[model samples]
Target: MSGTSVLALRLAGPLQSWGASSRFTRRTTESAPTKSGVIGLLAAAAGIERGDDARLAPLAALRFGVRIDQPGTRIRDFHTAHHAVTGASMPLSERFYLADAVFLAAVEGDHTLLTGLRDALRAPVYAPYLGRRSCPPAGRVDLGLHEGARLHDVLQSMPWQASAWYRRGNRSPQALTVLREAGPGESVQTADVQRDQPVSFNAAHRRHALRTVVTLPVIPGLAAAGGSRDMHDPYAALDAFDAVEALEDERP
Candidate 1:
């Protein structure tokens, strides 16, 4: 048996509050940590604790992807606290309200960990959400596992729709245009012009990077090609990959 790798994703909506900062008179909002937070969620699914961060930190080697579906609107909350005049227990004050927000996240990890993590999502013992208690997941987890003769092969052929805002220059070259100008496996360095300079977007770059991730071929058992995986240790059993295959195979 060999180990597998898969992409684990979750889409959340409604209202959320990360509660990154809070004070007696003022408060603030913080977006969720797409990388660390998803890892922590996986740790929780694996029954890992805060103290286990070091032990499980190695798992970070796996690639992570997050898609903020709604990017929910931000809102402000208000609150107040009180103290007893007699030096006794202080009475609670009135509750305040804030605006609603939502976020979506996707994480890629080892197949074994991912498989168990996916099962945990079905009936997770803990509450796995985007950011706040009020904001809940909009739908089921969106999990995907590259399928082909090999992981690298699948990644090389993965589909990625180009952005519509792209424009080619007369004398300069762009990353996406380079992808179109040159054949596959080509690289380019765009010139730093004033107005015709190339543009980079995190969203598009994330998608592009994700498509190239399969190039790394994290799935175990597959023979390492072009230094994609560890040549010496490529026969380990991958739970996440196996689970993804099983799940996809069963899907219509």
Candidate 2:
């Protein structure tokens, strides 16, 4: 595509569930939002019906990436239901969700499509949810459009969307983690592979493909450290105290 633009989305919610390998009895969630979940959100914004393959194809082809600003804790719930036809009780089912998480998602595509998507999200035809209908977005879903930006650039430039408490706990104000979809034949240094790409959303013949996602560390508004130090090291606190004392001693 020529002159691509990225439509940025802030997917912060109380309960977000992006299921990857869910079965009948247990519904699990991926640590990060899946490609299928994101595309489905776009489709909803565009008013595409469930089985509308023609309208869904373009959205599915977009390059998707997600930055996990805050990797929320996983919470599970036990639920039981009764059969509709009979009075038989169904087995207990375990549902998983990420509580109080914030993700920055980028969908890079043509400028026209990106602008259209931004507008649609602002006043979506169908109400958008954080994966499941029960889990709705907690904040403004659209973060506006980034013109002529690639996936990596968008991830790096987007501001941190973590909660105030989470940001306060961070060692550095600029700390952030990015998870981008790897390009073709690109060597992935550290990544987790997931099979969540949607080939067909048809219930009768659902299909997906494998996608490689690389995790990257981004430090905005700060220079890179000379060397890495463990934030959780007990000695680090002592070292900081020593440094403060040395500075105090040097002061006039």
Candidate 3:
């Protein structure tokens, strides 16, 4: 590894769409965030224009991985548009999205580069989105930056970041599924391939190359972080209700 730092991001939203490939009028989303999508987010935060391939090269070189804290359900919708000048009806399009999903995205690279990215994320030159412009992050994307840390290690050490309600329903100790770029010297048949490795973000000549990805089940002890605190019981807060009785009596 050439770099020794990692940047962590908490990517959660009511609706997110990460499409590695878009076919004509049909756009489908992946179950988790893709490397190219996250790189696009960082590039936008740094104010790098879509056509600036030189600046994006270093960002694309960073190792990318994501922990699926919560794999929200997939939903679809259809959309149609009309030509602005001609006022002619356009073909209908189908789009898919993930609802109520939460993810922990991590990238490891040079310390200086990662630190700059962390700052840009805090106050981005351009607004950041989950995967598309329509799917803005529910909250801040910067969880923190880890100096002298590796990509998978930082991702594995984070606490469960799922929403309160979602964790309550699934109280069991769960093993989070992690998808990360494979390390050097892995067998070709063992690693999966994705064409999301960005070659250029230019809308006119957008291109991607294949990448080897390895799936690992990490964070098996999620129950420690998903204990009773996140569990939902109808009367779980009744003890505190007694102290608020005076305020309740004054309600108009």
Candidate 4:
């Protein structure tokens, strides 16, 4: 492990919430995973605590990207609770999540550092969650480690990680969208600016800066093929996904 490497992740789960702008009573989620959120996840896997910014800096500097393999439905919920100290009812919170979504995430950086991070994920000190604590990963996050690889190459060339149910009705790579960090000297006019770059993860003063992102197609081995994707309800495949899971569980 001497040079650059990319660590890919499979981020499919029953629910996910990547909130960039969270308020006191209303928490909203971004459509895809955020850099800050994903970095925080890696830090947790590496056993870095919330207040340890010194250990968090290297993970934060890694380039990040995510492919929307399955852009799940946005659903909302109302949360009500009581304050333990005061025994008073807390204000109602309106929370949002992406249900039945599957994402492919990747981070690129020093090979030696990435290797240790991957090993830590295999046996994490603190469990990883989607953007919120209530949402957990449906399965293992590790995809594989690609040495001497770059983020763009790994994200685009990897096979579509969408669920089998999603593949039945949709083109895997053809219908997918990749949201990635801008390349060197990429025009700011072409990329969308979002406030997700993590500066610190200390609970007392969590901070994030802005980063530019560009959207592209997930056409890897296939030649440029032009066609329209069939529009279907994001929640339409719930039953099928459940059925598939049952079959998997029943297998020896």
Model 4 — which ten-residue stretch has the worst lDDT? 223-232
Candidate numbers, best TM-score first, in rank order: 3, 4, 2, 1
TM-score of 3: 0.86
Regions of candidate 4 where Cα sits further than 4 Å from its true position? 185-189, 220-252
> What is candidate 1's lDDT per residue for 1-252, written digit by digit as tens?
136565535344444444332444454444433343455455555565545445455544444433222234566544444555756544443222223322223444456666666777766766675544454554454445532123232322322211111111111111111111111364535421111011221223311111221111121112211211111222235645798899999999
Can you give the lDDT of residue 157 in candidate 2?
68
Residue 142, candidate 1: Cα error in Å is: 4.7
Q: How many collisions per candidate? A: 14, 0, 0, 0
Residue-by-residue lDDT tens digits, candidate 2, 196-244? 8877777787778887778877754333221221122335578789999
TM-score for all models, in order of appearance = 0.44, 0.81, 0.86, 0.85
User: What residue pairs clash in candidate 4, if any at all?
Assistant: none
Task: State the local distance difference test value for candidate 2.
Answer: 0.80
For model 1 the local lDDT of residue 183 reads 18
Error of 1 at 69 (Å): 3.1
The regions of model 3 sitting more than 4 angstroms off are 1-3, 185-189, 220-252
lDDT of 3 by residue, 98-196 (tens): 988889899988989988999999899999998889998877788888888877787788888787666668864358899998655645456689999
Off by over 4 Å in 2: 171-174, 184-191, 221-252
